[model samples]
Target: MSGSRLGPEWVPGPDGLLSRHAARVILLDPSGRVLLVRGHDADEPERSWWFTVGGGLEPGESPRAAAVRETAEETGLELRPEQLEGPVLTRSAIFDFFRVTCRQEEQFFLARLAGGTATELSDAGWTAGEREVLDEMRWWDVAELEAELAGGAVVYPSNLPALVRSLLTGWDGSCAHLGEVEE
Candidate 1:
């Protein structure tokens, strides 16, 4: 089997099933708030905490490409190359992750989008089935975002927002540099 893994960089696992790397883009608005979407999965009265907008890396696709695709799909916002940030961490796929006893983590990237109302599009397919899946979209200040996490309203591998808070702490907001945690 002479095939290559997707993404520009590839790593092989013991099973020989190629390890896939994907990227996610988290955009911050001017007030130092971050953008997140309410995951469509929650059926309870409460909604899933806000999530950064983005998706999966396709075959032969770059993390950047996946980020672009996810953002466009989830929010209908098209992102330029200038908007993306760092690839934070590379994680295992869910099935393999549990098999290995560690949750799969996605590579998180920081992004900046021109602030304004996001054009709500489509039927809220995956993130929100019909418009119901998306539930709604909202921006949360660091403290509030943290609060949701503390209350366990949010999900994991999103250990991201906490890290983002740390990185942006004391930031005057003009800085564009992003740091990372290697795979």
Candidate 2:
């Protein structure tokens, strides 16, 4: 798979990259805070509330490609991933992926954007405190995310806080020890 190149199909073009449909949550690390989108162009108050840049898989497109695309469209960031844990979200019990047995499992991939911008934010930026739409674009510490989980505040479909935490932990060490860096 060394000299191969993948097309937009699940057939593993030439590079040998896996062909799986997935979603990506782009976490922008600024000086000490992380960047997040509110709502789309139509939601209430309405745009980038407590969310990150993301979208569904496109035909033939890999999850990493999707992640890069989303960060550009959503945050206008023109950066690539530092690394990631490929995730599959499905009802196929988490234990199933381990070789057990399960029903269904949807898949998702996550990446973090370090330095880059959209040139024009659709109301984009960072969060230090809280806002009406987001309670604020907070560069939350790992504890905050854990707290949200403990309190059960992740009610948004597109907002996968726990999953995000998991990916971050996979990349770094612990979500609780994650450092908030801003650009």
Candidate 3:
């Protein structure tokens, strides 16, 4: 078994699946480009995918709190919980990573950089396990992200482009459930 699943955050659900609750950030720049990270399963480095910045919620933490903390840890961007907008989207994702089959329920929040100029992101706060799996980070325009998906790049939440497009216009102040996503 891969050591990735050894963390206390990964617990067994009633179905015997490793389960996790995560809070994700849809961090955007002034130009509407969203930041994402590219990573591979520790046990399958050859297979990589692009995903948002966030992580499993710590014990006794609120989703909003977790989102703020995760953003700071993953990108070195300090943001107060109030700075984030709606848990814009929510979804359940089941996938294999680090040789472990896992189920994660995620809540995504949207936040934008304060200034027009892009803030330089830092990986200095990443945990050792994150450094091992995550290798690249970049901001992507919606159109470019759509193109990449169309061209066969693996991206989480598969509907991210459309989701971003909708959120770019504006969120309806309601959290939309994306149901189950198989990745």
lDDT of 1: 0.56
Q: 2 or 3, which is superior by TM-score? A: 3
Q: Find the 10 residues in a row with the least total lDDT in model 3.
A: 1-10
Candidate 3 local accuracy as lDDT? Answer: 0.88
RMSDs, each prediction? 6.9, 12.7, 1.7
Q: lDDT (0-100) at residue 51 of candidate 2?
A: 48
Weakest 10 consecutive residues, lDDT, candidate 1?
Answer: 95-104
TM-score of 1: 0.61
Residue range 14-50, candidate 1, lDDT tens digits: 6554454557776676566776777533344343445
Report the number of the highest-TM-score candidate.
3
Order the candidates by lDDT, highest first — what do you get?
A: 3, 1, 2
* TM-score to true structure, per model: 0.61, 0.43, 0.95
Model 2 TM-score (2 dp): 0.43
Runs in model 2 with CA error above 4 Å? 1-22, 26-35, 40-49, 88-106, 113-138, 146-183
Please write out the lDDT profile of model 3 over residues 70-127, one tens digit for every residue. 9888988888898899899999998988788889999999997766554689999998
* Candidate 2: C-alpha lDDT: 0.41
Cα lDDT listed for each candidate: 0.56, 0.41, 0.88
True-vs-predicted CA distance for residue 128, candidate 3, Å: 1.0
